[model samples]
Target: MSQQQDLNLFVDNSIIPQKVYRDEPLFGVITHTQGTSPSWLINLLIENALYGTCVINHEKNQHRQLRSNVVVISFLNDFDFYEKDLKRNGIEVNDNQQFHFIDLFTDLFQKINTPESIVKIFDQLSKTIQNIPNKKTILIEGIEFLLSSTGITSIQLLNQINKLNKIADALFIITGADKELIDIQHANPSLPEFKTLDFIIRLLHRSNIVLGLRPLETGRAKDITGTLTISKGTIPFDSLVVSEKEYLFFVSRETTKLFFR
Candidate 1:
């Protein structure tokens, strides 16, 4: 398929925010998270906010040393990945602080698709997100969960994105993509989704600081869990490192190393 076709697909999916957030009926805090990268996104955001750096191995650093307003919003399944580091790094959040997650089908059906529950759910979730302090940076993460052919995660994700975008200057870290995206032909399909050049491009267009992970033949690629795709820009489970500047164009493998800095 042509790049325009690919871009069209992405724009079709993501267009709601680009327009809705621009004006009209605004809802609560909105953010996206993938089955992958919850750990890295949370840690990177916290580390950057606190130490102005990235933490490759937490055990090597002084736990008590971090001091910053860091909030990690994660889904139920992936919460454990960052739980230990969060406590060690002095960031704490109650269950209420985390955004409630659902898939796109449910979001459309129960929330948007249906007339009754959608607004109610949005109101409740929005209130929950709104209560969080605006000045503090929040790491929003949630699982899109596996959906059947009939199921959808888009509505729920859009809700989260809508909610979060309301807060000015909030460093929103969003992850996740349509599982079927890989079936599409991306220019550089060799790279992982999270690390793909297009993924970085789309991410940097939306976010201020983007760090995507791509696996290498060696190094930390072995244990890291996730699939990376350039065309789709979503991963099954893998690691990647992406930066804001590199997102707009072809990024060399060596350039990804800069994220460690």
Candidate 2:
């Protein structure tokens, strides 16, 4: 928005509310349209949690007084890709001791084919963070990918997520809200698309905050890429304070810029 607003940027990153997440656990959900990418936003969050500050995020001047250990379970991108992006934002994912990336994208073959397989995955994922001594912030990208790939049901997946959620100081789930995924015209509970839509809806209901992204409603503009909307969730914590806000953002090869919408 403005230089003055940058002084108070996201609660200290004011769009992100770093203060509210300092002590208690935080659960956030982000949904993106098909053409809009949430990767840059996710990278910014990782930077905020790991470094406790923002360098080239939406606003470079924002600050995080509390740093957290970050664990990311990504189903859409590989380590190499994320590593490259984060490096631009000052995170050395490979060398950092507190940053962990679980590459479910490249290693999706570890699918849950049976009930025992599901347990193995649940235990493995949990143990990964249980060993970490610091306060943990876990981010899951494309968790819905698990639905189509594994035999695990939506209820079962949500249960595992809830248990994992309890382990972290902050948890963020990123999913696609593209209409194709959520369309219910010929709803089939058996399909993973419908299953994923249901899963995302439940998450939205429980999440304290939701950061949503979508393509420009009007025709494309050279300077703007998409819009980011932050809204309080259905069951947000009474203590969690956030106002519904929107921003026009542009992500370029080297940096991201934001403008009041």
Candidate 3:
């Protein structure tokens, strides 16, 4: 398929209003993996945001005029991990002013000795964002991991996200939505898994776009990585047009490949 066709099949943002803040375009990536993993889709979005363009097969495929600086708040991986991945993909995001990576995976818990420290994180993030003088997009990964590790309730974490959104221009989040996480049978609110499921469901209701990634029902294959379902969130704008579709995707050594159904 042509690159344009592929872009549309994935998500043609031209059809999206791309509003931020109150009408901010919230995109959710429902990853089955319990913890951090190398997600090709997340990296792709980061690259596009940083460069204001999309490069596919060593060529430019699309151009976005309004490029937003990226702030990565990762509970999944550290800076070195993402830096290495981007380097392997021929993009050097590290040290670039447009890209800022915050490693919540390392040393975050060690520093959270007091209950007050939990709230301090939001303050820290707000200050970090205030320093950046550009349209900002926050990429949050491993929120489930954070909820499981920290003492914050699902509502509190969701509120924190909204608090950050009040200052951020856009938001992109990655959370787990596996059966174990979302199951409500004999649900216990005290359990971290339950809180995580609650947080994700609430976010889904507010998201503008949702991407569900899971293993194939037919099982794994050498060429196929997994299945990706792209659809609008439960509360998309009335005037918006969403292309709900599913496709097979592969994560190769050099780049990602998407196959339309």
Candidate 4:
């Protein structure tokens, strides 16, 4: 399929309102468990970059973008991994001037415990934003990993996000947690170290848009099922209520559709 067609299939356009990006910074949370796959979210991020939306990728380079406008920052992985993945994803990486990869792991990891180092990283991020053109969307992946690895608190991350929102027109974040563990914690209500759940809840409280993806409960092999919960946002279709509402969705490689059922 063409790239445009692939982009359309990656997301359900009916669930997103027109010009929603204009009103507020778009924040998205995508959750999945250990066994489930989050490739759909990765595809969505790539689509955004391919569509000429500036992307600041931080997902550790599981995928690649062909567009020169996409900039990737590799934290946990090496630059070669990103180059290989980009090629695997059909994105050419032949000394492309537009496509850039910044290796942050070496410098940041050496001084991860120092407050000065953290501040330096944040300063670098700010500088990068300043250079980007105005009114562009920034996609951030692996937020959870960043926090856990760097020992950054939720408040600190939120503050960084707020800063990014001030500079960028829109922002989308992708984070994942184990669904089964969350369920076990929910049922027990006494499990310790619900850190993932706590982080997810805190982020959700601050997010304008939220999406959850998991495998089908019925064990169906054809499609994945999840819930798309919207709160304090507008959607394109009138069928979606403006207020907080949860809609069940089926996602396959071919398409993504939302419904009440």
Q: How many times do residue backbones clash in model 2? A: 6
The Cα local distance difference test for each model comes to 0.36, 0.77, 0.69, 0.50
Error of 1 at 198 (Å): 13
Cα-based TM-score, every candidate: 0.44, 0.88, 0.85, 0.60
Q: Supply every candidate's count of residue pairs whose N, Cα or C atoms clash at under 3 angstroms.
A: 36, 6, 1, 2
Error of 2 at 230 (Å): 0.4
lDDT of 4 at 65: 37
Candidate 2, residue 2: CA error in Å? Answer: 8.3
Q: Residue 37 CA error for candidate 2 (Å)?
A: 0.9
- Candidate 2 segments exceeding 4 Å error: 1-22, 57-66, 110-116
Clash number for candidate 1? 36
Off by over 4 Å in 1: 1-38, 50-71, 76-81, 88-119, 146-156, 177-181, 185-205, 217-261
lDDT of 4 at 237: 23
Writing each residue's lDDT as its tens digit, candidate 2 over 1-261 gives 353122112332343455545665678999998778999889878877776666654446655344678899888898899999988886677878888888777656656456467667878899878988868889999878777767777788899888789788888999888777777776777787788888998898888888889989996878889888887777756455666678788888998777777
**Model 4 per-residue lDDT tens digits across residues 13-32:** 32233243355345555566
With a 3 Å backbone cut-off (N, CA, C), the pairs that clash in candidate 3 are 20-24
Candidate 2, RMSD to the unseen true structure = 2.9
Model 2 lDDT at residue 180: 76
| Tens-digit per-residue lDDT, 59-103, candidate 1 | 325443333344444433344445555555444533433322232
